[model samples]
Target: MEVTHAVEFLLLVLLEKLSWSDTKVVLPDANVTCIIPEDCILPCSFKPTSTVVIHWYKQQIPVHSYYYNKDQFGLQNKHFSGRTCLFNSHIPHGNASLLLRRVKVQDRGRYKCYTSTRKHNQEMFVNLEVKGQCAAMVLAPVYLGLATFTASADCFYLFAPAQLWVVERAPIQTVTITMTDEWVTCSSQNVYPVPQISWATNPPSSQHAIENSTIRTTDHKGLFTVESMVRIVGNLTSYTYLCSFKSADKTQVWTASWKNQEDLTYEEGHPVLIPCNAPQMLRNFSLTWTFTSSSEPTLILRYDNRTRHTVNQWEGQAELDQDLVLLGDGSLLLKKPNSQDHSGTYTCTFTAVNTKRIFQTNVNITVAATSVDEQSMQRSWWSTAASAVFVLFTVIVALLQCVKQNAKENRTASHRHNGTGVIEGGLLLYMDLNPSAVRVRPHGAGAHEQESSLVTGPDHCDRTLEPSPEAEQEEEPAEPAEEANEEQRDRFECNEPV
Candidate 1:
């Protein structure tokens, strides 16, 4: 038994030496991008000789401790005890990958993967990046609790926490306070950190909401929908309202308006039809058209009811029909199309006796040219000609049928000749009328004698005519003969032999 154990030990040592010789460790390049609060993985793997030990480090600091042979290092790293783990449980198979759970902005940094073997030690590195979650941006007065917000990216993680500040301009005061999910609401009676705060929301306008004099924080399970209002101090004044939010790291996304914004659609060069009918006559109205390139709109046309005339880059090309007594339908017509007019918003404004309204439309246009080959053109032309030929053939057939019917009647009349009726002004005269007869000549006594003799004269002559079988018939159809006789008599009565 001792000898057998010695042999097995030697074999195991040989295998370990072979594994160390073939060991290869690699890691993906660092500097990756990840949205805030999103989970990410930093891949790592290595091979080892006899005994293997794997460890995960964060920026050279010990993160997850794994002692393959000892099984004790894994219990020491408290922060990574439950959050970090190896990809495969069977370490003998040479899988040294690490998996991270619930990543945060603090997780955005360099990570190290290390492996130790009987022969040597190997290590690899990975870098993580965190990005903001929401695409919707808002800007508002610095009052404590006046707006509730949610972002597009749900993976956001709280980083450094967020703080509200009261910024002010001379003559105007601004105040803001940090809020928690539990106390999302504020009232006029409850004071806040920010008071006497007011600013105009119209960008350069200075209007603000007064903040209550209280500091609140809560560890809520989910996001909070903030409700806020402004108590105007001193007197009621007109001020624009702005709403804004910051990322976990205080990054501004974008801002939208509480008021209705216009979406204009139009095409370049085509006349944009702006039909206007106001309840009140627009005596104080002015019409304007603008061109937007990139994202900024530039004025191109303007009209005022006072001036009764409009000015525009497309001035002469524009036509407007206006009526004063009753609100006339103000229609603007544009002539001559071009690509520069292809995209942008066209707006029209009309001010009536009491109310002023503005309307906007957007236009987009595309143009293209096409080319055809010679073969296709030839095919099309020939196809048309073929149809014409077919129609002509049908017409000719119909005409020929009519001519044939008339000729047949003339032939039947000629066969019932009485006193050798003259063949004049007949369609058969123009045709090879007698298909069976070789010629027509005056039949005298000698001509009849020659025809009879010729039949008996030469062997070259076929029987001159076959005797009609009806000639030997004991009875004949009396009706047809009688009708023929009547027709012959009628003809004789019309023209007697001269």
Candidate 2:
């Protein structure tokens, strides 16, 4: 062997010149940030000698210690009291940096640094990050992520592309609150999360808020249905609502409250109840009664648990209280109250199973202002008895038309005071020939001997025919109509028959 290969190459060169003092595994340093209150500088260095010793731990607490010649906090950490320090002449140029002031936010973590000098003891670590300060603001609408922000006022919108973002803000978004109730419609279904509805008023109208018409589909199948409503119109002021239906990560919650606070007059046509209360001996409840006057919200009435049935959409105006409605008194009845269609805003709701209830009212009918002056004195005594029965029917039709025109001028002055040619059964002999006679025949043969031979010379036709004292004073006021026309001209012996 060549001297055994030169003694195995000098024993592999004496084990590569034997000098082992480094197990080798380093990796720490990298993180070190600071901003909470400000200051932080945890770097360090060593390897200079003159007996320079340094220490700075943060796990076993004591942070910052320099040997004998200076800076040595008494086991420091009264939360880094008076905030740590160093750079003391840069620790004689070996620079065992620390500084730390103000920082707090638990000052972050991992920081070791232990350096010593009597020959070898350097440690390092580093990782003390404390961040979250951001305030020099300039983001009006700047989100490098989510999106969709159609705001109206107070804002906190967006989240999509890293999510997306854009924001703008002012304030008020319809806050006029005297809230007599304008919203209450919770819902839920196939629930895998998604729920949130709230409205409060127990004495809190501060900042105003309560106007949601939400309708996540009256929600069903999996469960949910809360309803609340109110409207007393005009001189409004009746509040005390409180509704909450949570579980959108809220873990769960349910609440309901109500109030009506009086102002329900009546008189106009009388018949109103508008009161409600339910939840005492409940029996599978479900009731509703909405009327919201002007803006249309009608659901007049509905009941659904008396074995299921009852709906009164205003036919008969509306009613409820079927024997005290399950003893919880859901009173409502507006029979005739018509103040131009029953004043307005009724709202009554009472559901069961995980319950909910709502009720509100404001009626004021008035109009029977008593007898109003006795109905205007009975309408002026019926217009003076209809003007005295129309003046006695116009004086009995002018005394029966002046006794039928003075009995037709006394039968034409006794047929001209005795002018002849008359026959009762002789067909028709009405003659005074020249006195405008009018005779007609057809009474049977010889018509009374042809009317007695044409009224037979009539003794020159009866010389007893005397009249003329101005026609007997115009037939003396129609003396019995001239004795019945002189007994009809002596039985038509001849006389007047024009």
Candidate 3:
């Protein structure tokens, strides 16, 4: 009898829609799943003729937890602000689906839709699943990253989900969204076979494509750099973009492809291993590391089956363990992650042996820890060293250029300035060694050049007096002498004949 009852309940449990006929309230049950850093919209509708109040709530501890409505809890939860919006512009007499702007893992909960009519009250349940979206979203997660993603509605009913690729701002690949009853999937495996996202364009510098390329661009606090590079507010902030290549045949290729939806939290000084992989069996693969400080790709290191030192500060310290196996379960290990490694996308590339089959994975790491005094001191030393080296290089180059320019200027001046010119700085080609003359144009002066006029002291302009040698001598006295003389002289000594 119990088995029959369960079977009967399963057979009778059918997905249905709500109606607003005759001032009666009816509810429907639906389930929704979204990934973190992605957007999800709840589909809902109501009959246009019913005069009812619709409310949405997150059902968990409290009996009543309203999220969206004209009033009430709408003003309470700040997280839902600008994130929850009504799908239909005409809500009173049209669809009332709620659109959650950016979904997070914590947002997974049971959502209730209530419609209170003049005569009856009805409700619906929306089961939400907030899983990490694409491998990219899990690997390199950011809010608002999920935009303009729509999969075939029919995919939701299929068993084998199709890949849904999100191509925003022409992301160099065609992405298709295929859904299945169990899950929705997104893939960027060149559905249409486009060129890889140019690392040159990633940091977006005017640079060429290279195996290991890095670009550095300062992202101002309020400035948008990548998609819509706009300065909404202030000066630029610094960010690094790394461009690398990986192959499918490299050892530990799967580790690179596996992306984590959750943020990796770490304590200070401890090394963390990030899984990296090749597209195929990890056998023939080449890995490189690069860093971007600003609009330029600073090459760090390239794996030539042998480790090579790079000019990048971080890459110089990078070392790959030869004894460790990178095939089948490919992984990249960092010796020690410091606060300096806090923000940036770490790219791992794999290349097939003697083939062009390359696979790549990007992992964004955030390091949060208090640095030890020694580590801080070491960081300061390295920072100072790098700054000093850069400054020295700049100064040396500038001095050399100045010297070369000075020689050129000396030659040019020898030809132009027969007796008076001296080389002051390099490359001042347009500068006048001996400025001929500057004519001061009086207020409201005409456009044409005017004849030179003598500039006199304020009291003597256009006013001439009889020659008084003593007074004339006093005119050009030193400032201190003038002050002393003024103090020594009597106040009424200069008496005007009345």
Candidate 4:
């Protein structure tokens, strides 16, 4: 009976220890699969304490530990030497996570966390699964380093693998909403490892068509110097562009991405990648994509995961990946999505096992306004100048016509003034009345004045006569009297000659 009671007491003590070790860590029941050769973090938390003591174990073997306000890893396993760490600053905040660097296949196991402090203590467990070396997912993983990308919308597209440890579901890190002539530059200097540069365009352009052109050269100090000059905004154009720099050794990386507005924008005349996120891991799915450009909705693309079939009504303008459809990414590939051909609202309806997800993206594709050709402007200016010259010439011709008409009128007036007969008749009337205005005659008598009537000159002399208004009106007899006067003047001159 004594042996039985002792066995029962020992069993009770073991039960108490097991119950006390059961702790709360991040994703207690979930298995976190870490990609090989990358750093992995096993998270843990405890009650806050200034005097912190943390111990990590794998099958009762010490992996890492910290005590007396300092890391005392002398008791850590040699297999994990220099590969484990506890964030010292986070200890006071109840974080007792372990960072395992350069993960290997042997590192895959269930880990136990034992934490202690002056006031409280806690414990937890973390199971890390290791994936095959270089076994990458079909969905491309963005390995961001020490780089900055401004104005890119393709940043939030990193989806976690199906039911695995999520490294990072990517999110937008940077964006630049700038006007024309704005130069977005990403450069780095005095770096040890040679750097690689690339650009991520909104429409997913080819390498040749990307805007970020990075120039790289090694300096004398064996450090890499890299510079990228994103050229001027070709037009008053809006496009989501990103420039990323990564170290060749994959140690340091920088990635920057941004969106122009809350609504998405696509590049005109360039093939674009329209992003769609599935609600969950789809096993058997039916996908439908409807596009509304200006009117009624039309089905542009449809796919079935069960049959591995695709229907595209866009006439080879739309593309899809059936392999990636099973995963979380259901992004559509559009060829030359332009305002003329692809401007609209796109709706992606993904129906799968236990999930019906709908993703929508408004594509506002703006084609760069065609520049007014300089040659055409020159032609227009020449046309305008020619029109002005033509108008001036017409005015000059009109003025010349006026001058000729005035000269003809003046000549006609002079001819009429000189050839009028009424003026001659008026002169004859003056001779009949007072002839002094035309010819004047005075009487000069001599010795023969009594014999010769010529000396008296009663008819040769121009006499001043007083005529009534009625006699002056009769212009008929005045002309004959003028003729007789002329004959008498001729006789007078002949007789008076020496």
Best by lDDT: 4
Q: Candidate 2: RMSD over Cα atoms?
A: 26.0
Error of 3 at 182 (Å): 55
Quote model 4's TM-score: 0.27
- By summed lDDT, the worst window of 10 consecutive residues in model 1 runs over 165-174
Question: TM-score of each candidate?
Answer: 0.26, 0.27, 0.24, 0.27
Q: Which regions of candidate 1 deviate over 4 angstroms?
A: 1-31, 48-50, 69-81, 136-498
TM-score of 1: 0.26
Per-residue lDDT tens digits for candidate 3, residues 144-198, read: 3332233221111111123223322212222222222222222334211122322
* TM-score-based ranking: 4, 2, 1, 3
Per model, state how many residue pairs clash: 37, 13, 43, 7
Model 1 C-alpha RMSD to native: 22.8
lDDT of 1 by residue, 1-498 (tens): 657655744654354345343545565566666654445666765664567866677764556655545443322345556666665565666667666676644566787777767656566887766555444443432332543333233221222234211111111011222122122222121121112312224333324334423323323212222234433333222222333322233222211112112343444544655454443444566656565557777776666767667676766766665553134455556665445654555555554432234444454443322213466777889999999999999999999999999999999876765233333432111112333332112223322111111133355345333222432241144444545434433543454321
lDDT of 3: 0.42
Question: In candidate 3, how many Å is residue 351 off?
Answer: 34
Candidate 3 positional error at 374, Å: 50
On residues 1-498, what C-alpha lDDT tens digit does candidate 4 reach at each position?
657655744653354354343343333533577865689999888887556667788987778877677886555678999999988887889888899998865687889887765554566788888753331334434543532212111111222233222222121222222222466565666543445667665656566655675667754322346667665443313555566666554544564433232346765767788887663576787888888777999999888888888888986788887777777677888877667768777777776532345556678877644423666788899999999999999999999999999999999866664523123321311122232223213223311110112222456454333223443344345565555444544554465421
> Which is superior by lDDT, 1 or 2?
2
CA shift of 479, model 3, Å: 93
Evaluate all candidate structures by whole-model CA lDDT and list the values in order.
Answer: 0.45, 0.59, 0.42, 0.60
Residues 137-201, candidate 2: write the lDDT tens digits: 43355433334333223222344444322222211111112243444333433332235666766
User: If the candidates were sorted by their lDDT against the true structure, best first, what order would they fall in?
Assistant: 4, 2, 1, 3
